[model samples]
Target chain A: MNNEMKLSFSSYSSNESFARATVAAFVAQLDPTIEELSDLKTAVSEAVTNCIVHAYRDAIGMVYITASISKDRRITVKIRDKGCGIPDIAKAMEPLFSTGGEERAGLGFSVMESFTDSLRVRSKVGQGTTIIMHKKLAGRLSGFAR
Target chain B: MGVRFVLKDDHLTAILSGEIDHHAASGMREEIDRKAGQAKPKLLTLDFSQVTFMDSSGIGLIMGRYRLMQALRGSLTVLDLSQQMKRVVNLSGVGQLVPLENSRPPRKPKASAKSKPKETIPETVEQEPPQPEEESRDIYSHSEWENQEKKEVMVHE
Candidate 1:
């Protein structure tokens, strides 16, 4: 299960859904259940959204996404943005702590955390931010890598 | 960003589908509010059973509906939620303001979910419903206004 695909797009809010749909299609080769695929799309949506709303706040930048199916049928996604970085990862990951004001529910990280098997974030104040999330598909493998 | 409005007995149910994000949420908030305002239903219900995914923007959409219902002195209830959506709505404290009906087990999806309505409903609900030509006030939130300003400044800078 070494199938991998990556794409980069502008950090516009409109592209959030596009990123989700594209990644879901790329990962469909794993034959994930409907719910599983939906969750993965939702998680990816949150990650890309964070990059657009929080990371690039009030501006536009480049957002890169990479999806890979590992040996254990786990789908891993990494969403990164070259914009403002989060200062506190722990605080940001809280269930209802959003820095985007009333417009934001602040559950971006929590949503990703809930939908995926594991959520990891690495960021620096003046550099950029990246979110890595992985989820194992439920059904048997479709063998896209080999 | 597909929406279908079901106007039942004194209740208006807005069934939202597809991926719900900030861009989609903005359009939904405006259109739903307008329709609900005109209908003035005794109970304004938001049906999320068809919604596959939503983000923080969803919370804002529901919260906006709650505020509009309050202004109208009408009750608001959210119904037919998937487990994932229920988590989002409850976590945002919207549950406290509006009673969320139908927990909706993982399977056995509800018949009322209405993934896509017939030709009776518009595809996107983009057109603003006819109004009495009231004073056009700034409709965007503070953050939205700030975003517009920032976009302009960034372009010039």
Candidate 2:
């Protein structure tokens, strides 16, 4: 569970999917069930998408994703981006609320919240935003540290 | 994105191939509406078999089709979805409207759904035969057009 891999890519919409797939493949060796894998991928996509759409504000930036499976059988993912930080996490997390128009459904945070067991966001205005999500994988936990 | 149509006895199957995003939605809408109307199918199936990728715009496309089918009293089904496509479709709640069916052979292309328009069907005739093309202006044209206009606005911005 201690294995950590990082990737740097432009804050493009297409890259969001790549980030999710990359993280999913990296953690697939942990023997997660098909459903678990799907959930993790969905969660990752949402997080990365948020970084691309909201944090980056249509500007070029790098998104760093780290995945680790803790001894407690918890799979942790942290998506960090050095872009526009969330000034009001509470309002941003509201369902059906989005800064963008109809193109953005504002459901990204809701999807992330529903998919993962534990979700947290740490951000500071004018700095950047970081999202951490955790899911409890069944069976033995990996012996990896974050 | 390319949309191929196959008309069976009473089903008009539209196989959506390639990526379905905002960029490809206008063509997809027109194609699906034309084929569905022409076939006059009792069941419309949107085969996602060859669809390599999809985004929220794809979800919008499916939802639009679902509404059209409902108005026609026809069932809509999806098939041949990648695991990622399945995840996105399921999350969007379209899975509930048109649940995925078991894999089946492609439908016959010659037997179109247009043969028995509801108005012409004989009384007590539930299943009608295939017919020729019946061109009808798409009812969703305005909405689809608005979407395109919005896209243009975004592009110009």
The interface RMSD values of the models, given in order, are 12.5, 12.7
TM-score of each: 0.74, 0.59
Question: How would you encode candidate 1's per-residue C-alpha lDDT over B13-74 as one tens digit per residue?
Answer: 89888768877887788788889978999889888888877766788778778888888889
Q: Which CAPRI tier for candidate 1? A: incorrect
- Tell me, by lDDT, which candidate is best: 1
Task: Summing lDDT over every window of 10 consecutive residues in candidate 1 chain B, give the lowest-scoring window.
Answer: B129-138
Give me the candidate number with maximum TM-score. 1
Give lDDT: candidate 2, residue B4: 87
TM-score of 2: 0.59
Which portions of model 1 show Cα errors greater than 4 Å?
A139-146, B6-10, B102-157
After aligning candidate 1 to the native by TM-score, how far in Å is the CA of B81 from where it should be? 2.1
Model 1 agreement with the true structure over A8-124: per-residue lDDT tens digits = 999888888889999988877665655677788778888888888778887888999998987678888988888889888899888778777676777787778778999889999
Model 1's chain B yields a TM-score of: 0.64
Q: List the residue pairs that clash in candidate 1.
A: none
